[model samples]
Target chain A: MNQADSSTIVVKRTIAATVDELFDAWLDPDSLAQWMHPGTTALSTASVDARVGGAFEVLMHYPDKPLRHHGVYRQIERNRKLSFTWISDATQHSETLVTVEFNVASAGTEIVLTHERLPGQVACAEHTQGWTLAFELLADLAAKPLVLVTFDWVPEMPRGFVRDIRVRWALEEAGLPYRVQSVPFSDRNADHFSHQPFGQVPWLTDGDLSIFETGAILLHLGERSEALLPAGPRGRAETLEWLFAALNSVEMASLPWSLLQFSGNNDGTPGWNMMDSFLKKSRLAHLEPLLAKREWLAGPFSIADIVMADVLRLVDRFDGLADYPACRAYVARATARPAFLKAHADQMAHFAAAD
Target chain B: MNQADSSTIVVKRTIAATVDELFDAWLDPDSLAQWMHPGTTALSTASVDARVGGAFEVLMHYPDKPLRHHGVYRQIERNRKLSFTWISDATQHSETLVTVEFNVASAGTEIVLTHERLPGQVACAEHTQGWTLAFELLADLAAKPLVLVTFDWVPEMPRGFVRDIRVRWALEEAGLPYRVQSVPFSDRNADHFSHQPFGQVPWLTDGDLSIFETGAILLHLGERSEALLPAGPRGRAETLEWLFAALNSVEMASLPWSLLQFSGNNDGTPGWNMMDSFLKKSRLAHLEPLLAKREWLAGPFSIADIVMADVLRLVDRFDGLADYPACRAYVARATARPAFLKAHADQMAHFAAAD
Candidate 1:
């Protein structure tokens, strides 16, 4: 009847590594500077305090931005556990808790991390989904000899519409030989549901494992090929930040724009008007400045570009993106890659076959 | 246009280490084991494919539950970028992406990570928020000699209500010195807005960094202490899973339960009985089994406990939780903490003064 019985979310991960090795990396600040961030810039400052009730901080600076993130430690439990509070001075939002646990397993070490107690339901659900994706990426990056796998499905393929361009491009950019698993929209049914939770095409499988979400699959592959992300802690952190901006900041603005076009109504309904207004304002206020300088969101052709380009591409379906020349040029550069072309062709063929 | 234009969420972090020293820890499977999981069990079955178009996988097993997580690599860009997909085969509905980028920053390597395209808006926001907290935790764990800082505030302290016990307990657990920042409910001025985008209380700061969300702040502290998270990757992952479940799954289910009791007032109206019955059934069905399991939601004392305790506490306030012994016990343990007591006392005193 203790307080432990009522929790709902549980996170558990097992990695193949010895406990001592894992503990050393966690305890030593030097080791953290390595894999902490997968893509983007690099770490500018990192300091540690490992004793109980001690405090610590890490500052990650982006070469392309004026912002710096500072994280402070709350608790330290040697090799067994680590806990801390997270905050972004730039945003001034309430901090969140992150707890990491380590133990020994037959194969190696098992890591358990719990980030809990977001302010609201919306925030909680969002973090749950995002963390799930990030963990997958971590596992793939940690894997050895890197494995790359890809699948191809077209937008108009099979009996319905599918968005397979993302996976195709990911495979192409990573230089992985992939196969096509196209399904007509008409045939996407219970069988598909069993394989893909969302009942969508462009699902990917590596060995016996299967993934449905496009972004998740792409990140997984990026870990294997190291082609979609940057190398270094600060770089990786920056890459992750862009990923969030793509999904949250940029994507949030794009939704209404897409919805307005999809609905195909110009009426000034309360919701529609609100959406349109939001889209217009957000684009001018946030996105315009974001694209004013950088050729890429982070630096190189990381998955951040892939995500932004995909979302931005959808904007072209509705409002021609000519007004945002920077965004347009960025998209053009991203799609101009040979690998992107191959992936696009493969996806188009799948859809054409459906026709 | 400057670097800030290209990047919005960049930070300047300086560390002392060569690129090879940092990169090796992430690339070498053995080195990864050291810091991969800070709190729980060590990693098991770690493998990597460092080349482009390679494959990678990591498997983690949970000792107390029949759960295992598999992370698959999707792309890798050698000492540069890594992406992967995470999946929980047992859940059948779990899919996520994680991208990590590595780069050189000053004398050390910077890592940027992006987890893109979560399931939905709610999921995306929550995950992004969670990452901020987790990053703080990671930073703290990396820093050995830590200096902890924290803050406490009540939800409706301005109106003489104190419900932010969790924040206080977290601070106490980490044994950090802190101060209180009070806000009035009626104060909707720019000052409040500057501190909290959502105008909520329980905001915190660490040196120049500030955080507004309670959950995020807790995680930031937890990462520094490593006391709240289990050891090992598997354990760490599982802990994170529970953190999500507590925040989204169980907490979401409890919402209806609370609304039914306090906001129900059927009056035999249309959809009244249906709504009430639905809420009752949903709440019971979701919680009964969760209570039947082990003492804690994930294991031992963790952030999941803090989150679930808060959620259940809310439920109890509306309708006494006498029926659910496990849940009730869970609440009792959380409230019994000395930090919780101090927070409650301080909140009460603040409210009393306001009155």
Candidate 2:
């Protein structure tokens, strides 16, 4: 980038992507097709030769007409940097030097794009605008790099009920990319509360959208893929209603009820009797009939089932669901889901590591 | 219903609407514009004279072109029946007799729509389907006839924490039509459990769709209108995440802590100490920053605010918000909304009546 030359322009973006991932997006045709085009243009079709001296053509489909840009790779240093010659009609059909550097940054990877030796000031400005628009879309590549926030460790009693398992289950179900970050269970600080107001485990960060609460995070992930949430109006409605049901309805009883069981406080105290009666009469009894009739709560397998099954799973752990065969069966069926199994195992491993 | 005659057809539906509301839907032009369509047509431009022997014309916008269906009121019986002369292109441009009876039934207002003097079998079949389609939309009248089921009464300690206030607050915020139904607090039978799995009160019935759990019910109501929820993606995403944060994150700590207060159990016991530590450290301290920064949890007022405020209200009842001014102000800000005031008053009244 020549700061003194008015004919050259540079743009930089710090993307939440790994070094290799950001570097590869520029060379892969499929990846290029997703983010290479200017904001005004439709999808760009590209074919890349990848190595040095290899030629590439990207045809961007605008509403009015198609524009083709051809370039030759001058240098390729794997994840480090790439320098190429870019020739387009906007550049007066002249060859220009384009370099992209993927630098390892504290947050993620920062990409510095330089386009030099433009036709004049206008071409430089156009290329700058074009690259800026492309970067806006390129930022989407970072959106998938989710951070699942939860406690570092908890006791055996709250193992499955640690709640992060719900989010892990959802991320797995959606086939999303996420990494778990644990906070200190014994010592929570002001920083932790900023992300999760309740200082609870299982908050999630998707790009800048940091959301706490298991149900909220599940919903956030559910919106990412139909595997977690359906797209249609009817199915979406059912999924939303049922997902809330698992947390607000089923878990409202199950959580406190499970805690009592954990403490062995069910020695027929008033608190114990109140919780037990409510669990047996209010929750499990109603769940039995509904579970008996349906394979899943909503029309298909969805995030709603993930929450509902997890809520009932806690009760079944304490042998609370013994009489409710359908509820028991439903729990077994949902836990048997490959994603649930993976999420559960992952959560157990996360805690074991902390221990 | 005209069971004996094949030429005459009758369609009946038990709509969860008041007799007066059902009868009014037939006479009102705005109401006609809502549901009076052939299932394929767009919004209907309706102009109704309403009185006996008065005319009405509904111009339905179909994909291809516009269609005009005209009618004259032959009889007007307020809440009882509506007899009119129906004519359209499908009726061979010939006049037909249509009578609608709104009878009070055990479940709701049952509407019997009978059409006679059709041109032929094809015309009869077409009108049968058209009216049936109209009824399908008319059945939506029942959708607003929400039945909020909760406990009849509880002690003063559990008065404001009854949970139904969440749904009631949502309903009022949305300005939706609903009625409250009470189940026995002491005795929750098999019948009560049918609607709610945890035999909990506060399960909601929206026509045929019954959803239990305060969060689920609020979401269900939020979907009905943007008043309790935003329609835009960003706003909705914030609403959903914050709502779950309120319940699963904030209330997860507050509920148990409040229970300990209700029992006056502050003896430094392990359970009591654990609940206390979590409420102050994990929840309120974290919530203070967010409440201080934002006027509402989402971009605008939403169901998320309702749940969050209500959760804090319980804590405030026990002087829990004394240390956190932001959390206290947030609760005050939310409860000051007219809907919350009405819901709280009505809940108190309902329990008081039972007492």
Candidate 3:
């Protein structure tokens, strides 16, 4: 067995709409507004350019706040393949890529999303957990039957990264039933790579559909559930903006900061110095203002909180996050959820068994 | 000015809608579906999670082929900031980050987007040009009066990259007026960083808005005019997916292939050998399939083709791309556009001035 063999979480659900209708929900601005948010604010004014080499952008607004988010379409294939580049309104130079695939299945539209080329392994793990939870939420919103497959590896299973907790919390919040498919790291193999293109664990397969990357899975799940996202235009937009902030803005900064523990040899190498500088200027500096403004990053207890809490947990592992009181408090709120408890317990049990 | 300073390109445009309204268009999935794809198809579904710690995803579908794109939100600041990660369903492992900011302006929203933390300098240059053209497309979609601001630097003047052709084409396509501000590279003052985040040329500003990266610029421009995108759900989705394939999938592969020229040095290193393997495995493998199926990358002549053509042009620069008849045909189709001709002529004129 190898690291990829160990599985930690599983989800199953049935959607209310047909495969084509459910798939169409992704393209239609109105349908998107209907089920995009779990329980926060609703989406307002959805717009898109659905074409080859066409530009697509969306703005989501919160009624009481001034927050918003924008995205551009990188690629689009009707009901089959979609990809784009994403960035936040807050920073100038940080960008990430996301892709989702929808395959028609006997059961329904089998959706598989793969988010790749992350900065490093740590990011991969963090996103793996976050995406798992979000997908659960999506299943709930779509009222569709779905399944999620994930694993927990030994020796390097970042215990501090609490993204699993978020997934668990979303499931609990939605009052959904799920199962676990724990695979020991010793059992991982090439087959796992077939499921996860990168060979990393924490992948999900819904019937014939399979998805890798935590962020993409989370989105798939979130779109299905009403408990994970809000129901109105303003609320939904607010929720969406926070989602971007958590994955792109906060997570981007935290990845490098958390990696310091593994790479910090205290040597005078240029790479170390560069990493250190990035930690100071890029990660820490931006986080300060972000945490100071809100109790939950956005409004209510959305997936944004889940992703941020997980990222913060990793930062806390190295004692780097002690300075941010808001972040610490936010982490506490997210972990308090019952689903988070279940997810964490499952991870611990799986890790113990592997040991 | 030196050769580096001679080839700089500047682009700009204006968009209607208030700063908040325009900003909301980004966060709201519904609004995104509207102007997002100006000339292509209508958006089928648009979803968002606009919160700090939330996870957001948008999937755009095509009208004809089996292509779909999904994006995840990473950051958010009410009405002021947003960011997210981008990935492709095809590659599934490569991820990139993008960010945008909305400033409250008396006239309208001054949106500034920054796409950063790319793999390296080569990727950075290509992204800058691609983003610029995208922003130009955005401006056209928005249908607001706008202007273009550009700067000339001695070292970074004509920022030589393939995507510049796309930016020039977008400007001509929209028939938008633009101006340039020349800066000598010798003057590495703080102001340079303010105009061009990386201190490179091809930076742009419209009214209170300032942006860097050709892709972002094209999106901004496309938002102004509806002509850049298709008109229906499937058409718009196809356009967006093709855009992503051009930038993330196709361009990514082409970049490494082109870099081989720089690596074949007299230093007696194995750079050429590494480059050869890279081209044969990565670039050729992907291009073969992409060219076999589509006449244009996505459909018709969208921004995706513009960017793809520019990137593929490099293939001819090093070795002839004639082997790929489909790719050659696509290039011819793209170049045949009147807008492309003007952009090419403008670029040539700029180069001619350098002599």
Candidate 4:
């Protein structure tokens, strides 16, 4: 369509997020599902084609009806701009042009969204409200880069087994950018306790909010990005529940058993042997039946898998998960992810740098 | 304030919740905190006076400042009506009468909230908007009565140890009413698997939403009521983290160790003995120092405490918690709550009813 024949409407919003992060939200299918829809409508299905001339489709689900929007990417400029042709069943128009420009602002990223080739004024007005609400949601999420805090170094045995790996894996999986800060493991200061009351590592700082507990940090991040979770309430709830199950149920057993193995107490006493058997019969065995039924704990790869895999990997180190083939395979499948590999390498390098 | 002299504004809503459940939401401190505030604002504190002439106070906290509202309960009728006086610094009037009437509706509960004795037109309009939003929040929550599904009976050992206790405790803590249904323990049919994929008891159904996993159920309930959780983001996050810690961490070890003890396999196998020792040395011992520093796990009484206490209590029965004096005291303190008492009694009676 010629510029003279088409009409254009622009909506601008300043978000409290980095240019790259905010820009990535547009191209990432998971992130788009989280904030693209209006009101309480959830994205039932979202698929992305990030390159020029590639096509993308997203199905927005409401209680009564589902609205599917599909478009072809006409222009792609990472962290700067994105332009595409949009068509939806709800709209009378066969095709419309939508362009999003991301500019670095004092606070964060300023997003300028322009919708061109509108059929009429009514469609423009309706889309204006929809885009306004969508940006508001994005702005709220892009408000900050979550800060992950951890230790500079730890004991040799637990070197790769640090709690910070969970946080790193979580951030990497979500495709969220974060900076890591370190504290002394042996000599924890009052400030450390202020952030993490237990004087533990892997607390998080998101803007003015300081949150302790690795599970809590993961949950906070999960709330913002759909990569670690899902937009549907039931899916989100399942992810959360499974995440807890991994940490509280499986890890609870594995941690102690691994500690015994690390401390040279493996099969040393009756107690040590009993603990090993319990880990095998109670935690891992129970998990086998559950894992056998599905590849992922919550049906989709989520934070639950990340935490569960991390914990179970420790058990596998001691060969405790041998009988539970499904559990072992589940852990292997999760660690095979590029995100997990990067997180593992980065964690090892972090401690190596301090050395 | 007499009805003749006062100006009353009635905000009516048809919620999708049972009359008893909806009515109890007002008297329940936890339930009130979830839906009482406007928009994203959270309750800092909510204390209930569920009797006639008793006083109550609720502090709604914003990021910048806090708004405190306190008044006397003029009347209370269970599953019928609740009337109280509303006062805040923002208001010119010292007191305003607020009455909420709950009636059974075709969809759910029809709630008519009457706010009387407005100072001016502006105040009237603002309060109207605030109450309207608050009711919308309630309607969203009350639209579903969470269902707790469990087995009719189990082994003598796992009788009181059923997972349903966690749900019952959470519901009681939040002052939310729920109905209990049973399945045959010997044969968990396909219908049971539909609700609980794991074929376990204690799945929850709210409206059309059915969720399994005890941790997930508790978290779901926490979203609706502040009693099982806290109103503030930090508190709620902490509660969630700790709840996971209790279930995944503490319960993971405790369940196995307790099962070994109950089966009289305490020293029967080397694995059982080792698990018992690990439970003592790692899980329970690590919890002691933390409990020594605080009365509750997450600062305030929450589902975290209930789940943790329940898990630790099992440890106590096996004499594993003897060394952890503080953990014992913490469990004692949690079980002492009236809600916990009622929940425990109800759970016991539920099994008894089948017998």
Candidate 3, which segments miss by more than 4 Å at Cα?
A1-144, A160-166, A182-190, A266-270, B1-355
How far residue B345's Cα lies from its native spot in candidate 4, in Å, is 1.2
By TM-score, the best candidate is: 2
Off-target runs (Cα >4 Å) in candidate 2 are: A1-162, A177-191, A231-235, A257-281, A288-293, A315-326, A348-355, B1-161, B177-192, B263-268, B350-355
- DockQ of model 2, rounded to 2 decimals: 0.23
lDDT of 3 by residue, A43-126 (tens): 333444555554444344455653343456777767667776644443232455567777666776666655544444555465
lDDT of 2 at A40: 32
- Score chain B of each candidate by TM-score: 0.50, 0.61, 0.52, 0.60
**Using alpha carbons, what is the TM-score of model 4?**
0.56
Residue range with the least summed lDDT across 10 consecutive positions in model 1 chain A: A152-161
**Please, what are the lDDT tens digits per residue for candidate 3 over residues B182-266?**
3444565667655543344455566665555565566556656555656554455455445544553345445534543433321
Worst 10 residues of 2 chain A by lDDT: A38-47
Candidates sorted by lDDT, best first: 2, 4, 3, 1
Q: Can you tell me the DockQ of model 4?
A: 0.20
Which tens-of-lDDT digit does each residue in B1-355 have in candidate 4? 3333336677788888788878877775546655777675343346675789888776677767868878999988888888889888746747888888989889878888888887766677788788888888777666436667788667666667687888888887887866565678889887986666556687888877878777777888888888778988778777877876677556766776776577665764456656676567656766788899998878778888888998988888778777789998988888888777767765665565444
Q: Which parts of model 4 are misplaced by more than 4 Å?
A: A1-145, A189-199, A260-295, A321-326, B1-144, B189-199, B256-295, B320-325
Candidates' C-alpha lDDT: 0.53, 0.79, 0.53, 0.76
lDDT of 1 at A67: 39
Model 2: per-residue Cα lDDT over B40-143, one tens digit each: 32546567787998998887778788798898999998898899998888877889889988889998888898899888787778887888888888776446
Tell me which of candidates 1 and 2 scores higher on lDDT.
2
DockQ of all models, two decimals each: 0.01, 0.23, 0.02, 0.20
TM-scores, all candidates, are 0.38, 0.58, 0.40, 0.56
